[model samples]
Target chain A: MFGDLTVDDNLRLGAWQLSGRGRSRRKQRDTSWVYELLPDLVRVRARKAGGLSGGQQQMVAVGRALMSRPEVLVIDELSLGLAPLIVADLAEHLTELNREQGTAVVLIEQNARLALDLCSRAYVLEAGRIAAEGDSAELAASPDIARAYLGEAQGLPSPPDAQDDPGPDDPGPDDPGPDDPGPDDPGPDDRGSADSGSHDRATADPAPTPGTAKTARGNQDTTVQSARAATREAK
Target chain B: MSDFLVYLITGLGTGCGIALIGSGLVLIHRVTRVVNFAQGTFAVVGALTAISLLDTGLPHGLAELLGVAVAAVVGLLFGVIAIGRRGTSPQAALVVTLGLGILAYAVEVMLWGDQGRSSEGLSGAVTVFGARIQTHYLLIIGVTMAVFAAMAALFGRTDAGKALSACSSNPYAARVVGISVTRMGLIAFAIGGALGGLAGVLLAPMNSVAFDSDVALIINGFAAAVVGSMHHIGRTLAGALFLGVAEAMVAGYGSATYQTVVALGLVLALMIGQAARTHSVVAEAG
Candidate 1:
């Protein structure tokens, strides 16, 4: 479905079962929420999903599912074939979605550290048998359980702070996360940093002041975005 | 040049009919991955239904619509039997459509008999570019264009249309996105059937439709669809028009018997070309 369809259309199909007033309402709410959740998707909304990179495709897939407004979203593998940073960013979005929308997410992951970090409850399956089940914090702390499944290969040190976001110095996925600036939180600092990283180079020759830099960066972003949209339309 | 113009105009009408059927074939194949051999049967049934209804003093327009509706119902039935099963492979579904075609043939024979049937199509000739052409041919052209336009809009502007295309692109992902693949398949078959029926109703007056006439219609339509690689609607229509014009020219310039040879040769050459292209692409990818 994603392969040949535009990101917008793919998102529309997610809410296929809805129609009439319900459809329009659901479509407006879910689509806006998805666009907000995955801002990168906004850039490539008109582009064919097949043309997108694998990570972009995955984001579209997640966003598409979210458009359905499912009460319990079952994701097959949240971290598959993605960089750990991307996985972290996505997990953060999922957490935010859960918190804001009260949408439950069931993530099936091989990466136990990430899963334990994001989820409250944990269930371990080995050879079609239930190996262990407990609170995620207890499962993560258990030496025997961690050794058996979450060993050196699957092990990545779980973020120590629960719900405490990475700091400004941390140039990890969180800093440039699309879902970073929630509606309530005005992360002006993060925005400045993100603009500096992506838009600074383009505007460096002109050496714009801090006051104009924001608007200049906004203009450049739109220009680049529209250029991409034009190319897509031409295609 | 006048003679050529006459032939081209006539060919355009014939091409429109063939293209309508080919479009149906292509639509079904695109969504369901099934080459519906029974598409021609939809035309035969529709024409027959319209003709039979005309005998009951029904208006021509209403009869034609009824014919299309009947064809859509038959399409849904075809979908249920052929594509509704969970494990049915495309190959299996294709064979089922063939069986349905045979079933339609039997039904046509029972109801309409083996004799040729005709309807009171618009009778009169119009002069265009110093050449006389049947007015009904123009109607056929108009109808085909209208149908194509509607389909294009449906696909391009509508959410349902996008969902159908999405189902074709990846059924698993489509399902995950909450699209019912079975529903899309059924809709595809029904739309394909309606298109086939409309083609039949339009072509009935121009050509005497017998029970077995579908064999020729399917053959020509299939030939055109194969030329487009069974995906592109515009390309399929163009292929149909090309086949129609080529057939008409061959019949006019040479003999009617030679037209079959030309069609067969064209199909063979195009299929081979397509095969070579696909093979090279696959080799390159590998």
Candidate 2:
């Protein structure tokens, strides 16, 4: 994200990939489409993203990636330094995105519980190598995974289930593959990167500062409730 | 009073030229992060092209237009050589610009000889208040304002301008969003060249420009650019105009020989002050 540029400008530049041959215009999706996905961003569209709060900056970052309308959305790390509630809200948006856009998302996170909650399948990366890979629930239950990520060995109460579960109306695991680009492909067809399954990734990376105020365990309750509320509003 | 007016007005005229050159420098450096040593050569190209066209009976406006166009093409070529290839660092490109400046001197000397040339553009003088100054000075000031306003509009109100600005503010983020950094760099250089060329043609009517006149011209531009943070147009213009006026006032009221010395000395002081200010700011932020 261009911190110096307005939220609108940052999102608009994403279209440069395959739209209008560098002419600064998208064929099907307009830049306003991003504001539609993240409605809270509209008021601050003219403000520079650099001066915005971490949560707003995260919104701008995700809105920028979605402007390209990619079939495969890859988020490196989603939970770094962000408030738990903010993370949940973003995850819920991602869930909604997956259901609506049918874009396959590969979200990599350092938080094991969040990753497992958001993803059906998971992989544990250790020292640049895959340590363990399996179903999210299975990995969560494994003693080794449980000890390392879930804090089960330490006897910490299990955190409530994250927004990874789809509601009655939303379809992600059941949706058609992203590989099957429907007749109305919103993005450039030549984007060779392809993927399977569905998840509209909206990784709102809280720009790692010195560190954020600790709001982890206390916010976890509201995090779940708001995540569900967001899913409902999205539906 | 008359003497003061002459010095002040003429200083502003030269100051306008420096601002144009500095604006070019800032624009290119802001986008590409390359310090082009050949910036002054652009003015030489424009002025010489205009002068050469006079022999062929082309009108003044057309000749000047062609001169600016030629300079823009040269700027594009400079961009291609400096940053066109992958892996060309800004340091490497800066060195290449120095070489290109030398190359321009060779071409200029071969065509126009090592001697100086001047043209009586917008011939005659205009009276201001109770004093008289060249009509050309008014033209220079007018044109400079128009150019700066256009530049401000381009960067502030246009999408292409914002994207170009984005290429510099956060280049890594810019690439992630799919902006062609190289293409934007080329555009900045071309615009820089046109501005340099405009300054040269404007200055041609006032003084004799030699093959090596760029050495002196660029000194003024670099000072203005450095003092202005090399990006902010309004500040660069203000700094350049002050330098021009100071140099002119010194020439008018004091010794002409000390003009370059005075200009350079002021730049050194301004540079040190800015550095100290920035250092203190960072310390406070920390």
Q: What lDDT is reached at residue B54 by model 2? A: 73
In model 1 chain B, which range of ten residues has the least summed lDDT?
A: B170-179
The true-versus-predicted C-alpha distance at residue B251 of model 1, in Å, is 1.8
Docking class of 1: incorrect
Over the true interface, candidate 2 deviates by an RMSD, in Å, of: 11.6
Off by over 4 Å in 1: A19-30, A130-138, A145-235
Model 2 segments beyond 4 Å from truth? A21-29, A126-135, A141-144, A153-235
lDDT of 2 at B85: 93
lDDT by residue (B7-124, candidate 1, tens digit) is 8878889999999899999999988889999999999999999999998999989999999999889888998999998757889999999999999888899999999999988889
Cα lDDT tens digits for candidate 2, A135-170: 777776787766554543432235564433322322
lDDT of 2 by residue, B1-286 (tens): 9989999999999999999999999999999889999999999998898888876899888898899999999999999999999668889999999999999888999999999998768978988887899899999999999999999999987778988988887665555565667899999999999999999999998988888999888999999999889878789999999999999998988999999899889999999999999999889867
Per-model chain A TM: 0.62, 0.62
